[model samples]
Target chain A: MRRRASLVLLALAVFFAALSPLVRWYAFPRLAKIPPSQYQDMVLEAKNATLLDYTTMKSKKVPEVSIVQTLKGNVAAAGKVRERTGRDVVVWDTLSYVADDKGRMVSRIPERYVFDAHSQEPVHAGGEHVDGDPVRRRGIEYKWPFGTEKRDYEYFDFQTRTSAPIHYKGTRTVHGLETYYFEQTIPWTKVKVPKKLPLGATPETVEQLGLERWYTTKRMFWVEPVTGAPVDGQEIHEEEMRWTDKPGKKPLTAFAGHVRMRPDYQKATVDLVSSQRRLVLTLTTYLPWGSLALGGLLLVGSLTLEARTRTRGRPPGAGGPPVSSAAPGDPARARRPSPAPGGSGGMAPGAVGAFTGAFLKLLPGRRPPDQLTPAARVPSCARWVRPLRDPPAKGAWDSGRATRPAHPGSPPPRTTRDRR
Target chain B: MRALLAAAAGLAAALALVLAVTATGAPPGETSKKPLHTTVPAHP
Candidate 1:
């Protein structure tokens, strides 16, 4: 028995020794990609994925969201606004549900509206933020009412190379729905700001001011407890910078709540709450970025995996095929005759063409790799390409730019939301 | 002594397999790090 136990211990050590590096390499990178803690929570809730059992020290105010589908085949949205103070719990009753085409659901439309106080009136000329550039505080203001509609994509476009962490907090039964409590957090450092800044602002001042204005948005999302999809969730915006003289009294933070109903997935109702009153907007359009994002992720992942395969230590079967040489007689012809069907190695025309394309891409003076290599491969993690032994001078280089260039699917800065 | 050594090696092999599986397994709850490029939409 003693011998057996000793063997077990030795095995455990060896097991960990071999496995630790793998974990550190693959698993560790994931930690960096996770979203901030607060955002993770809210994301899980919205995905209806799961819910975490969190201590509701204070319920605060619950903003009511009404989901609805609009005529343009887009998921249009409008919601009320609300904010509250202290531990005071406010009872809010707002009927918000998604509008469906009789009984069907559509989930991918990119514009939404935020309504005024309680009435259907939109606060800004455009219900949503203006589309093109992010607004700099005290910067050039768009026309009246339109100014109220803030364009976020300019400053908040999704990072194609980063991922937020999802945590399963716990489980709960809400209105007969068994939901899993999953949460995530998005750090302020990862936030993308506008390229240009307001007048009189230094780069440092711009970042500092941006952080101050947006940092306190602690978002707690609740997924469908069961399905891990969005059901309902809330956001608590606290001011990063505090005003003196009024200790404990920070500026009013916006509280927004959302929920998706049956029929159409595009339409949603949102609740925006303030200290004074609660407003609910219905038939708001929801821009479905989830599918678009997933597609981008798959493409990026396949590329990373291919890079890893190339860089990883060769497995036994790798490099087994005989190397081929080109013929000196003709530039385009192979020196040796093509391998026969029963030959040791032969690739079909299609497969050969694909391999040739990839191999040619790695050559210098060609376009850089469409997908950038992971941080590890980049030498020294250079601003664009890291310091590495062999930096590809030619090919498409991964600049590792903080924000990626815009894509077609991204919504326009100004959309019908403005007319609303 | 040789039997003991052989037993130890066998045990080590088994434990290594277990550890490999655990390490490769998906993270508990939600994934801590999602693969880069996976997009998460903002909730309404």
Candidate 2:
């Protein structure tokens, strides 16, 4: 009985141990991909900023300028891309809008970013990022990949339409989360005016008016490593319009600010990402290792049980099946083990009684050792093995062992001389 | 007594197996918050 149980435990341990890597490397990538239908938004504020009043064509100092950024996943677009690329994809329709304290419109940039749902690497599909200018995007943007490393990452800029290495500056505890701090500096670069300008003015027309846009920024991100989600972010952003045709024209400050996530938004982001971090760790780290540990413990338990059973289930001269343990014409002796076919046996030496069904080779699964006669009970103290044969029925007359004909399935015969 | 021990051992194995498989499930919830930002339509 004990040996059968140990075998069952050994099989279960191997099963769990084998499942560990499959959980980490296989299931995590497939299940944890960015949801293609997810939609998220954040609010950033820049205090005491400068904005160019287009009506007056002059730079004015404003009390605050706010940027509202929204990312809405395009399920249909991702589905279309996933079919061809054979990879899970996410298409994000992004909108960035700037406004003054009085809620006057400043500038708006709409973008379509496509990327691998698992790795976050940009996928250049048709008509991507922007219209007319199909800027081939590269590197990390908006968010990082899960299990982010403590090394530099190639970061992408939507405005410059280029990729640069963002250096990891060390670790930080932001909002009580241990995070990786990354920063990137972009130098001044001349850029195009918004295609969707107010008053229906075109970029060509704006260029004809000698108004050119120049921009530069220093970006910072604090990302939770497990979820690869940004808990806090900031950008020291500056933009100004200069004259290309006329050198003496006074340059207009288009926008300038040290923009940061709103305090409430930061708190919400931390709360949201913190929960996600735990889940990601569960699949990629915790579950795999936990299963492996449990498997190891089970393995030890099984081996110990087998050792103890072997030491205690065998009596003197019981290393092998006892001769004449079962008669040849006995129905129990003719029984074969399930699954492991062609085994003709009534009982195993150590496994005197057990389920002994499929794939287990013991038989005559009956009778507890405590009910056995003293000679039969000698070997069952350490191992809780039921005996192979049952006690004879009460008052039933049994022939003595000298006849060599009494069935062993019955208890040993009484020695009292019956002169009947 | 032996039957009870077998039952307890089976239960523990099932519980461990369930935990390992359930950990691979997808995270279903999403976040979408539109803050109080007033502005004219972005396009003309």
Candidate 3:
């Protein structure tokens, strides 16, 4: 029996080990999906969104982000980063779409306009800044082709899968004020290697790595639940995963980053705390790995139980000899005499009846006093017997609290007399 | 008789181990229904 139990346990361990990968394959994908609508509107409001841009070394840890808001067919920016180098480093091109009186895009503008200074100047290539105009010289240029021809995206439909219901973690503050926070398990989309770069490296390698891991986005929204105002919010995407590029690298510990917005929704501050650039990827891999391991364990345990239930007259898990029928005088059957004179109610001569009559008292209902104090006759039996047969009633009483009234001086109370 | 006894003992042992691990390894909350406390940040 002991051998069989050990084998069963070993089999269970193996089954769980084998099922680990399978469980992960099913669970991680589901956990990774989240509703796209939650952030789609805000993302459109914060047009040309860039969480972090590590294009140049000067902005190594710092991020150059932009949030655009288009209104009355005119685009306006709150915090737009323009690299003010002496030369024209980068250019901004405006997209124009022809709209009817009903305010719907009918056709797109053919020629793209580049603004160096004035809107009248039809330049081939655009510059970082427009000359002549003071605001245009200091700021990036914004131009439109002609009347009823300007581009604007009303809403952004981000491609994302729907998953489990998000658990409302209640509200928290980004910079200040209350905001509704929600959390859900989700996995990252598989990141393909950059073909332009050498074999597996690219400028956006870190960002790609972070996107490949499984993580839960902690999203906070500060809205006038009544007025439906987009006041402030934050998002912290985190995961735990191992580095595929560097073997033996410790998994990224708590790959967490937070982006907070001002009440006006004009400004947002993103702070990323990462030991390595590929933190999110590392986190994503490990969480699913751990969850899968637990699932595997459960699977293995169930399989082992099923195996034991297979009764073929042979031991369930043991490779040893098949168990045979026991002989007539097995120790188990010999433990109790056939047709016991006590008839199950009485105790053996020298044996204490504490187990026989008094055992039932331990249960929750009524029990007789005689049965409760069964050891009362031990001293009388010892006196009647030849050798020091029965243990002294006093010693037995002292040993167990159940023996108190079983002694000679402390006689067992009469139940009939108490009833009268 | 011996086979039956051994099977009973094995089942008991397995049950005890499962109970021990479950009781010790459960998460931070008990089964009783208790109101959750939420911290609402003040308006800034």
Candidate 4:
């Protein structure tokens, strides 16, 4: 019964060991996939300096205004690979609309983003890559190697239809989970500005607002480690236009402030962290250790069962066959005479003793004698010399010291008796 | 039999403890529900 149980436990251990890697490779990727119809909201506070009075030459102080944007998106597997690129695709449709304090829509933008399904790189949306170059679409949540510092990434921007270099800044704890932080700065020289101005603005005003040549955007993202999901984000949009062409003149402020992640976004991040933690713990920690513990238990049980069976078969009050009388530390103690013919009683006792002795030798502070011969210490098939129980008569044929007749014609060797 | 049962029980207990610790510990989320606002440099 115990043997059967141990075998079962061993099988279970193997099953769990195999399951760990399966969960890591197959189950985790499926769970980490972005579900369709996910909704996110971002509340941005647009700050812009307004002229208090056109007549007055005083600097204007404009209070910050709040603009809430709701983002609704769905990701779907594409039916066929693109003809030009020959890559599998996934289509993402997102609609973002700005709302006022009362939640009334002010402006709506509908965007269709197509990405390579396997690589998750943006293939076509606002612009096409030249000659099948891999466009870096950092906005997608599928980028990997989240916690490493090996390479920087080029993040694509949907609004400007450009990509900016983003570098790993450091690690930070968000909502109890460790996250990788990244920052991207688009300098004023690289910022693309529209050629035309709005209705109320003149050329002088547009130039002074830095709407012509001076505008920059800085973005930061805190991404979850395992899933590569951005949990927290901040974006700062800055633009300055000067009234004079002189180099030393201070520029007028257009818009300056950060757009922080909303609560809904934070909740999404926390959910991703929770899911990732569960998967990682199961794959890397719990399953492996559980399998090891089960295996250890099985081994101990097997050893105990074998010992019990041997003890049960031994006759009562029959002390185990006499062991060697040599001192425990003596080198001769390692050698034991072979069992006599038809003597089955000594085999089990000898096996148990050998097992114990080998086990004890593995313990710390115990050393085997150096003088012990290899034949005595290790079981082998080769014949070894053993002291005879009684010496042969002076003239009897003695194999130990016997020699063949020299060249088949030599006289027999003389014995000690003959010499005496 | 007793040894085996004891070892199995201990392992089960350890596995339970691991599951409990991992499941109960909550991931950090945003502390405040209110929106945060910050000002950036106009000229940089």
Q: Please tell me the interface RMSD, in Å, for model 1.
A: 16.2
Estimate the TM-score of every prediction.
0.20, 0.72, 0.21, 0.51
- lDDT of every predicted structure (CA atoms): 0.28, 0.68, 0.29, 0.45
lDDT of 3: 0.29
- Give candidate 1 regions above 4 Å deviation: A1-162, A187-212, A225-228, A239-420, B1-44
Q: Which candidate is the best by DockQ?
A: 2
Model 2 per-residue lDDT tens digits across residues A1-43: 7667776676666667766776787677877778887787788
List the pairs of residues colliding in candidate 2: none
What's model 1's TM-score?
A: 0.20
Which pairs clash in model 4? A175-B28, A176-B28, A208-A241, A210-A241
**Residue-level lDDT tens digits of model 4 in A161-271:** 566777888899888878788888877643333332233444456456543435677888877766566777777866555443575777554445565655554666578
CAPRI-wise, candidate 1 is incorrect
Writing each residue's lDDT as its tens digit, candidate 3 over B1-44 gives 32234334444554454346434531212212321111111221
Ranking by DockQ: 2, 1, 4, 3
Whichever of 1 and 2 has more DockQ, that candidate is 2
- lDDT (10s digit) by residue, model 3, range A213-294: 3345554444322112334545554433345676665544223344444333333311211122123223244544664565
Deviating ranges (above 4 Å) for candidate 4? A44-90, A96-109, A115-151, A189-214, A239-254, A263-268, A279-285, A288-420, B1-44
